[model samples]
Target: MSWIYLDNNATSKIDPAVLESMLPYLQESYGNASSVQHRMGREANQAIEVARQQVANKLSCRTNEIFFVSGATEGINMVLRGVAEAYRRKGQHIITCRTEHKAVLSTCAILEKRGVEITYLPVDEHGQIDLQLLEDSIRADTILVSIMAANNESGVIHPVDEIAALCRRKDVLYFCDATQYVGKQDLNLETTPIDILTFSAHKFHGPKGVGILYIRRKSKPIQIPALISGGKQEQGLRGGTLQVANIVGCGKALDIAKQQPHIRNYRDLLEREVLARIPQTFVHGSKAKRLDNTSFIAFRHIKSAELMTSLPDVALSTGSACASGLLDPSHVLKAMQVSDEDAFSSVRFSLSKFTEQSEISSAIDELVHTVEQIRTLSPVWKLFKDGLID
Candidate 1:
């Protein structure tokens, strides 16, 4: 069985063209971007600038706004930690959604230990944050409002444009983790008014270890000190020798992603078939605004672990790949107010542009069979069937 990978939210398959574009950088143009005094180094530096322009072009932001980072995790840390420290006198409060990626949540947790008050805005049943609640939550001491453009697990898209406008109106800085939205959605940072944004390359079929952090330059003056400061790299906001090849790959992948068709039809087919075929199934955040590539499905009385294990040829996820090992039902689902029983039974299937219609059908078949098999063997399912439990 040729393995079908539907976990694109975690990490997508690196595109062949992206790999080809970066090969020369890896094999031949192995010059330090910082060492631009020499010809090879200048060429490497030139490649980095070209990649920067590509990312800037996609975001509709200035080239100076984009800075390379290890990945979104590092970028997120830098923004949160830096803002918290640099703007401590301005305010000690931060507002963020309850369903943000662990990167943001965990950093907020650390900040809490250091006395930063964090307001975790709750989501309704459909995993959408109330704009009014967000607006009201902003305090005079609130220094930054952080929110994800698209959720990693449920694919629920928060109203980022509205959020950005609200922040601007309230005179607060806003940071958006656009990790899942960059390649899939149209993001115009120039007009968005978001003070900062970050996204990873691997989410868009780019190489791992390369990411971009975009900080708005002209109108909004926000100061975020460097967390990894050593050299004069990233305008002294971040310090590290650049990964030239990976950066090139990230740019190429992003350019490629823009041209690739949205496989929403395939995602819809998978969800539609699963709901029609499976008797007791639920799609979390189905009614909410969502990404076209992700479906978070719950099979009643069935553990996600068993279902995933039974289908070895298919690659799916119970939750974020970043939170893979722990038996905890997704924190995102928990925040969405999903019951313990339903949460444990849920699995996330994320598609990409490359996901074909044929693979969608096959995935649905496997999922239907697996859910049936698991339900048949489950004592809990038997009890539910016997009317012993609801």
Candidate 2:
């Protein structure tokens, strides 16, 4: 059985072109980037610099603005810890969302223990933050506002620019977790007034263990006590020997993402075909302005995990991969006010530029069969037939 990988949001497979670019670094130029005496070190440093430039080009920022970290999770931690430590005198409060990735939530939780107050802004039914509520949430004690550009599970895009503008006006720092949006959308730092941006390489077909953080040049940088401190790397913000090969791979992957076909048509095709075949299924999140490569759907009366387990050939998820172990309903849906029934029945299908229409058709066929089988055994459906489910 051929497996269909629809879980691009969890992590993308490394593109062949990126792998080829990384082979030289992994095999021949394994050297400490901080070492200045050796040729290997210089070569590694050069490769890393090139990668930095590529990332900068993609985000429309200068090379100096981009700092490499382990992954998006670390990047988010850096921004939060940095600001809370650096600007403690300025404020003791921050703003974020309940539906944010665990990385953001846990980091904030740590800060809260350290005496920082956080306001978790709520979302509308379509998983959109109320801009006015966000604006009101900003207090004189607010030091930062961290929000994701697109939700990992629902594929809902936030009004990041507007939020950034509010933060800018309030003289508070704005950070964006663009891990899921950067590769799929046209990101330009010039227009987006976010003070800091975080992204993971693996989300964009690059290797794991590599991520990026964009710190605006003009923004006042708060110094965070380093989490991994040893050497003077990442401009002393994150100190350690850099992973040169993964950086190179990330650059190549960004280039590929830039050149890949627009995902709108393919995503629409998948949505139309899948929904047409499975009429009882309901799409989650916004009907418009979502990530073009993602579609979240719920099969009536079917548990997401149960459906997923039945389709061995399809790769998918119930929500954020980090939250996969939890049996509880998705916090994202709850934040969006999704009903308990809808949350349990949902599955997230995220496509990539590499996904083919044939794969979508196959996925739809599998889903239809699975849902049919589940419905047959569903006591609720049986009750509905007997007019007892009302």
Candidate 3:
């Protein structure tokens, strides 16, 4: 069976362009970016800077503002720990959502143990944060408010601009976890008022193990203690030898995405066509303001994992990559108050710039057949007056 990959959200396949960009760095140009005396080091540094420029241009920010880290998980840890430790003298409170990725939640859990109070904001049925509640949650001791731009599970784009503005007005720092949104959507950080934003390269067709944290120069640097110490790498925030090749590839991938300006329209067609053919299936997020390349849908009476297994030709996910191997209901879905059945039946079909219309059509056909097959065997369906089994 020819497999169709629809799980771009978990981690995307490296694009040919990105892979090509990394060849010299991975082989002949291999050198520690920190080495200042050797030509090899200089070459690696040059490549790293070029990649930084690529990411900066995509984000509409200064290259220096982009700090490279291990990946989105590491980036979130750096920001959360940095802010909590550095500004702990000023405030002891932090706010985040119940639907945040495990990285963020785990970091918060650690902070809570260290005496930092945290508020997990609730989400609506569509997995959107309540702006009014968010505002109300911020207090004199609230030092930071970290929220995701696009949900990894539901594909719901949060009202980040509004949240950013609110944080600005209240003198609280705002951080956006855009790991799932970057490269898939247009981001103008200059006008956005987001104090900091985090993205991972693997989410956008680049190599894994590289993530970027965009820190607004004007914003007060959250005086957090460093998580990784030694070498003073990554501006002393994250210390380690930088992966120059992966960083270079990440930049190339962003540049490739930038050239494809019609990603929104392309993804809209996939959602429209898929929903048209399967009416009982519905998208998870607010359709109008989501990442153009993502769709999280529920297949009525069918389990997402079983459906995925039935169609060996297609690859997709029930939720985020970090949570995919487990059998629990998605935390994002539970936060949105989705029933256990609906949560179990949901799958995330994330497309990419390279995804063709024919591929989506074939996947949809296979998906329909798989759902029918599963429904026929479901004991729940046997109880129905009309078993619409195919």
Candidate 4:
């Protein structure tokens, strides 16, 4: 049976146009971008530069500011670790939100072991951080404030512009992990006070294993020491040969995403239908600004894993793919003060531009059926129905 994929936040399918754009580099134009002494290498290097410009154009930043990395995970590690090491003399404090992706949180954990002080800001029930608390958290020793543009599980958008402005006033460098927000939203680095931004192409209909790190160049540029050292690529910031085909795919995918209409209409329709059809269901981050493609919902007394198993044709997730295998409640939900049982009952349905109205209808039917079936076996659900539990 065909699958109805609703996990775009985890990763999106590569667009056909992006695949076509990458074919030449993978086939005949497979030359090392660094080897400029030869014609083939020159062609490859030119392609890489063109792709870089494409990405830069989409982000509305200078081409020199973009650097290619393996993926967002590497980019996050590079920024957090590099800044911590390079500016060790300046300060050793880094502030980040508690609901951040494992990429940021895990890196911060490592930094903590190495004598770096990390302040994890809390989020409200709607999965938003307190702006005043954020500003108050800044200190003379705080060198960086890293926050995500959007939550991977809840899809709630953070007030990044306000956060950036606060960081600027405090003289703290700001880093935004835009992996889930980049292609879906407009973020012009030229106008924003963001010092460092990272995104992976796979999150936006591009191939996997390719990402971009935007380091703004200013009079007092944020210095980041090299995380990987080899052939002096990426201005000696990140090393290793460029993945030409993947980079080309990323550029084409980002260009397409920028041109496409926002998928909010589809997402809203899906959520409306699901909430109307499924009893005892509610949305996470409903009051906050969220991405147009994400819906994180919790069904009382229904385990998301069991629901997912019952609807094999519907490609949904309990939470972030990185932490899904751990069998623990979602860190994001826990941070928002969602109970452990409710967190386990929650599932994330992230749509893409390619999702159709028919698919949404079908997913809702399957989900409603699956949840009803699961609830039939749940004594907790029966007790709630009898008003035994509030």
In the range 54-150, model 2's lDDT, one tens digit per residue, is 9999889999988899999998887898889888898899999988998999899999999999999987778888889988888888989999999
In the range 1-390, model 1's lDDT, one tens digit per residue, is: 578999999999998999999999998999999998999899999999999999998889899899999999998999999999999998999999889999999999999999999999999989999999999999999999999999999999999999999999998899999999999988888788888999999998999999999999855467889888799998998888999999999989887676345487788888889999998898999999899898999988888888899999999998788899987778899989999999988999999878988888888888888788888888999999999998
Q: Could you list the CA RMSD of all candidates, in the order they appear?
A: 1.1, 1.5, 2.4, 1.1
Q: How good is model 1 by TM-score?
A: 0.98
Evaluate model 2: give its TM-score: 0.96
Alpha carbon lDDT of each predicted model: 0.91, 0.86, 0.84, 0.91
Worst ten-residue run, lDDT, model 4? 256-265
Q: In lDDT terms, how accurate is model 4?
A: 0.91
Candidate 3 weakest ten by summed lDDT: 381-390
Give one digit per residue, the lDDT tens place, for model 3 in 1-390: 477888888888999989999999989999999996999999999999999998898888999788888888988998898888888888899999999999999999999999999999998887778899999999999999999998887778888889999999999999999998888778888878899899899998999988898888874454545678888876786778989999999889888775354555656666777678764678887543667777888877778878888888788888888876887899998998888998998988887877777787788778767777777787866655265542
Candidate 4 lDDT over 339-375, as tens digits, reads 9999998999999888987888788888878788888
Q: Return the TM-score for candidate 4, rounded to 2 decimals.
A: 0.98
> Which consecutive 10 residues in model 2 have the weakest lDDT in total?
219-228
lDDT of 2: 0.86
